[model samples]
Target: MKILPEISRTLSEYLLIPGLTTEDCTPDTVDLGTALVRHRIGEESGVRIATPLVSAIMQAVSSPELAVALAQVGGLAFIHQNQPVEEQAADVRAVKRHKAGFRTIEVTVGPDTPLGEVARQLSATEQGVAVVTRSGDTEGAFLGIISLDDFHLERHGAHESAGSRMRGRAGLVTAPVTASLSEANELIWEHHLDVLPVLDGDRVASLVLKRDYQAHKTYHRASVDGEKRLRVGAGINSRDFKDRVPALVEAGADVLCLDSSDGYSVYQAKTLEFVRETYGDAVSVGAGNVVDGRAFRYLADAGAAFVKVGIGGGAICTTRAQKGIGRGQASALLDVVEARDAYARETGVHVPLCCDGGLLNDSHMAMALAMGADFIMLGRYFARLDESPSPKVQIDGQWYKEYWGEGSQRAQNAARYGQGGRMVFEEGVDGFVPYAGSLYDNVERTRAKLTSTMISCGSTNLRDFHRDAVLVPVSAESFKQTGAEVQLRRPTADH
Candidate 1:
């Protein structure tokens, strides 16, 4: 039997002390509004994310709960496209239900609703503005929005008649409504206006306003999924690209994840180029899934905000095995590291790297961040939650949970991954993955473990964690100790 160290033993006896502790770790509570302005993404961006964490947009994973929870924590979530557009819209609505420390909500008012009445209602409700709806949702019609500030801009308070200011263009802010929040913020700053309207295919559906929109857009914050921070964004798909692009810009997504698998595909490349040509460098867009730096050079040169890294690291993914394509994750990250540095010097554009997969546990997560990934995308880690679509089931007597990949045939064919992945039969699965009560518990636990790991590594904050961590290859003995703590714990029973 191996001898255990005494409780009195000093840490230096076994591990090196960067002299770090939980106290040294910084809490990720930076105000998103301030970060945006600091980052220059937008000052009048309606949606603001405080943290850089973004939920993966895979249908089997992201949900309304995911959106709301991540938003609450100051990160943003991309509602996956696998679900019906209506469902995706509902998820977006759910995010608004809980404030992400922002000032506005993207609510719709009937087109027939009189402008004067709309202004009065906004004054009464104190919501500041409304995205005027012309037809059904997702139509991309821009009409106008009634802003109380704009209403007050042209007139005095209650003493001055609301009618004078409510008449004609004074009460309405029109639009192709297609400006990015950064553009809108600049317009608002330059023109001194309060509200900008967004048009759907047939009507105005939303308004971004000065008081309600985040003042600055470029600040990055720690993400909800991992250490990489996220700004605001809507994950878009092929079908809604044109219509939703403006909406995403208005919603305050700083970086767009382009939402494609093959970054090298002509369609994806063109889409990236189109966004750049149309918006210029007003917003940052990320494209992905090309294993080499060749694709990175093109996207970065095309003004991609960031580049996605990884091919088959998702839990349910079999891309490498199925497609016979993909470089190993560690190898890929190393390549991107070189690419990011070289590209930054040559182009003067610093594109942060997000390692998209191959992270299996906390150690792997630490390794990814340390190995130069600006952030890591976790699928299985976020799966198997109460918010996920899969309901609990009983299999063999042992309890287990469900997880999957976005590329799995079962997921795509059945559309099961959008709400939840395909449920595998595991005995006592319910008992195994009991609700675990609240997700907050899980988040807290994960954070604590991550923090402790950082302490062990002699680092504080994600930046330091990556910059200073020491990576020694693990030995057989260390691997065997994986379940030592669990093995030591025994259930107590009554006679």
Candidate 2:
């Protein structure tokens, strides 16, 4: 049995101190933005990740759809390495190919296709721009694109079916695929076309929508690569990263992270070097799950783009119980952060650090960031969300989602590693979390909580929270008094 840390000291021992009181400061003014551990998201870009979940796990943990969604909101999802490299690469492709931007080819309707079929196709794809083409291809020819405005007008005015209206390219404005973004934007602006389909000899190439083009041009918050696809990250274990990193980079992973639970080793270091040497400055590599100042320094010396902290901190983790190893999360994060500062001062390379696991609520997350994590990596918290690979299950009238840690034997099997399963000694557990809605909803709510907490603490931005925020120990009773401690009712049934 292990002695409780509270026997020596409790979490109530340290409390965060706030910033200077200001009436003008509001949560809206606060920006929780950060960068990929390499300090940049792209080739010469200042686009910062607003709230990232860096390297949570490989494909067994995160899905491509979730990755794309996170990137759209200015954060990244690490495509997990549990799947075959090609499948993982395909997920990356799907994320990079998602359209929250300029589209050259979208939904297409044939000139002779029935209006009912056209309506169904548009509804299914949620396609705003419907290009009318001969031979049923929105891809074929410089045929006229349908204007929703004119379609609606004709629908209400002349009572024309889609087939009749789409019979010719007369009313549509077309552009050659060779046109530059500026030229395309100009064409759309000049003609007031809502959707312009680029044509390759009458075949549709790319659908360029005006609003998306404007957002791509104006929104600084959107993280995009040189090709304009959102930036993304991938996780690879030290044992196999040398083989995986090359394929991952070619498949458009903007950053690479060593997903080892413990990374202070010669093998991990050598692989880190290989990635650094091969990719050069093209990709940033993150590594670790180090629990102390010494390990943090070691990783910094070995060129980790960012380091991970916490060992027995994850919700389902059993490392401490089984091996009698690991430190309390709070102590580990604070000490490692101090080491990060010292290393930065000595080497002039400020390697960003992420706090992995041990988070149970928004308040814990808030305190963690206040304690100096560049970002928080969540497992079970994310697992319960709608986007995770877990399927929702109904149990006793409550909804739940499956959650498993990478060290769990179930996770090994889930990854289809047969002999790998024999080696895993169950350092982690397979379990379930209460079904939370979508990741987007959960993250927004979490952001709101952070904003409220930061505002109450009198801090304006993340930097202020890091620099001016202070923690003062509180008594156990005092900690309870500070929160929702009053027990009024007992009956509960999913909120």
Candidate 3:
């Protein structure tokens, strides 16, 4: 057993490449956007902006709903494989079938829905338009369209004014289902309409909302798969890969990640080969939880689309302390990145490198990105979100979410480990996490901070950040100096 500190420097004392920024390049418009991930994108590939975030393999942390939420925000969630194949597959299906691709159905209501109800729905979304359809069915016949302003009328029962119909029906314009994004945009502009319902023979198949067109005009990246549905992924253990992979694939999971504390086993190698050969390029798989260059090479050779790196760096992981088989996150990440680049140079295949743990905050995420990680994976962070499966409990009048590692006794038992498989050697722990209101708030805030970091580093896009980022080494004392705070404590104790 060897301590990580003895082997490598930890993330607490590392950095990203810095840059000279001019006032012209602002964080708000710095284009810190990601390519909508469908299949895995390699780090050195021209279109290699993998989604910025992912959730680690914690069944209680990443729920089906959390997976959907993450996808909508240009990230992926590995629906944990710790549950039954049926349950895990359902989780993947929930995310895959969540939102129809190219179809904006977020704000929809029934025709008979009163103005009050409609307004409430409208207020819940940031989209400028509210849609009315039969039975409030997203794909039902279009009834009418309403604007955000319609809800603001202070007249008595102003909500009811929308009535059995809204004013926009008289001017209701729609695009054909076959309409491309450009055609939809053109229709919106030509009709001077704020919303265009996409029709598949009188049924509203989709809504080309104005705001989405305006927002993503430049990048044109939505979290859609080849099916045009929101892209989703699921985790599968090597032991259950044969059974789980097919079910997850059938459920429309666009990618499968090998969910293991360690991914360099012969079992993983065989499983990776099976997925790649059977599914071909139809599905991408992330293989790992290994540390360093050699492990990265092994997974890449085993048909891993991307390699996950990090060992015992998780908040709940005790692998380093108990087993002493983990490396510091910064060192592990750099080694894998180097391996990925070297592999690309030799084989013309650039596998994406993922940092799977030790991201305590946005600063760590920024460092990982600038250090060339295609994406960052998190567990405890997502476990605290309202959408996660972590049960909430009250502690001292404040709410906290339950979080546990896959290797914990609770998880292993739920997974039915040791019945006929591996021995019961817990590598992670169960703990409480402070309540985080929603996935949107938490993920968006992280994204915002990362965007700011990119701007400060004078990089317009993720690729630029990775290519030009400057790592300025600083001592522990120096790093502490930047955040040094002297607290005045008032102790209250029993007499």
| Residues 87-123 of candidate 3: C-alpha lDDT, one tens digit per residue | 9887776666544325556677776677776767666
Which scores better on lDDT, 1 or 2? 2
Which lDDT tens digits does candidate 2 get at residues 1-495?
655444322232566666666885687687878755644222322335876454377433578767766676666788888767788777777666654445635467666655556656677766665777666665465455554443554354433455665525666676786777778788998999777766677577777787777566544455567666777778876666766887888888877777766777777789888877887766778888898898988887888888898888788888788777677788888889899878767766667888887787877888888888888887777777778877789999999988777767766732222245364466778777899888768777888888887887888777678877888766778767768757888768964
Q: Each model's TM-score?
A: 0.60, 0.79, 0.74
Query: Where in model 1 is the C-alpha error above 4 Å?
Result: 1-52, 84-90, 100-232, 238-240, 247-255, 397-402, 413-437, 475-478, 481-487, 491-495
Write candidate 1's Cα lDDT for 148-238 as tens digits.
6545433454444333333233355444445555665666667676655544445553455666344223222323222121233456654
C-alpha lDDT of residue 182 in model 3: 80
Superpose all Cα atoms of candidate 2 onto the true structure and report the RMSD in Å to 1 decimal.
6.0
RMSD of each: 12.3, 6.0, 7.1
Q: Which ten residues in a row have the lowest lDDT in candidate 2?
A: 38-47
Who wins the lDDT comparison? Answer: 3
